[model samples]
Target: MVAKAVVKPAVELPVRADEDSWTEAELAEVRATLEAEMAALVAEIAHAESTIAEDGGGDGAGDDQADAGAKTYEREHEMALAHNARDLLVQCERAVRRMDAGTYGVCESCTRPIGKARLQAFPRATMCVACKQREERR
Candidate 1:
């Protein structure tokens, strides 16, 4: 019988000794990226609210049936987007908290420094790439 190979867990990287492990420049970049994303999400929510408001401006007017249907669809779509954005905002807030706690780059699952590239792509990631992949599998 053939034996299945065991997958080893990824190794953790050493934490930097300096108080501010990440360079000030890097922290600034991350802050800017997060702020921009937050602004965009808020704008999207405003736009959705405006659209719904416009659809419901009239007071018991003609074509109420069509207006009701359109308003319902818009509300559902807007609500979904709002919920997703709210969740992402929560994640972003947690990442910012980690930065303040001096554990921003360290992966929550393995205590490893998530590489610069990964941090740039996913600033809110709490797990390293390997751990994240493993989580997705389950």
Candidate 2:
């Protein structure tokens, strides 16, 4: 007699359709948050650019060294902040796209509906907790 191998099916994720889906109020809140964050990032970028232009000036030897140090520090800090802002913007854009596609709170990895709490915290997560952990491990 040949032994039959049993295979388990992958877990099925829940889907929120129509009336069971995220409320209008929840979506409004997320939109508001994304807008606020985007605005702040834009302002920061503008300020950084202005500072950089102002800092680039000729001065005496001692003053030149100090200015160089200051400029370097400012450049590094601004670069980091700009990178962070750009990443956030990308995430916000993805969230908006998901909302339009009716997959806002769905995990991309496991095809499961992400919890409301997670959505509230992240607002841009593409994977559920379990799948996220699995991915990170690799």
Model 2 deviation from the true structure expressed as Cα RMSD, one decimal place: 11.6
Error of 1 at 63 (Å): 5.2
Q: For each candidate, give its TM-score against the true structure.
A: 0.69, 0.70
Q: Report the lDDT tens digits of candidate 1 across residue range 13-66.
A: 223343334556777788688878877877877776776677657665565788
| Candidate no. 2 TM-score | 0.70
Give the number of colliding residue pairs in candidate 1.
Answer: 0
- State which candidate has the highest TM-score: 2
The 10-residue segment of model 2 with minimum total lDDT is: 7-16
Q: Best candidate per lDDT, number?
A: 1
TM-score of 1: 0.69
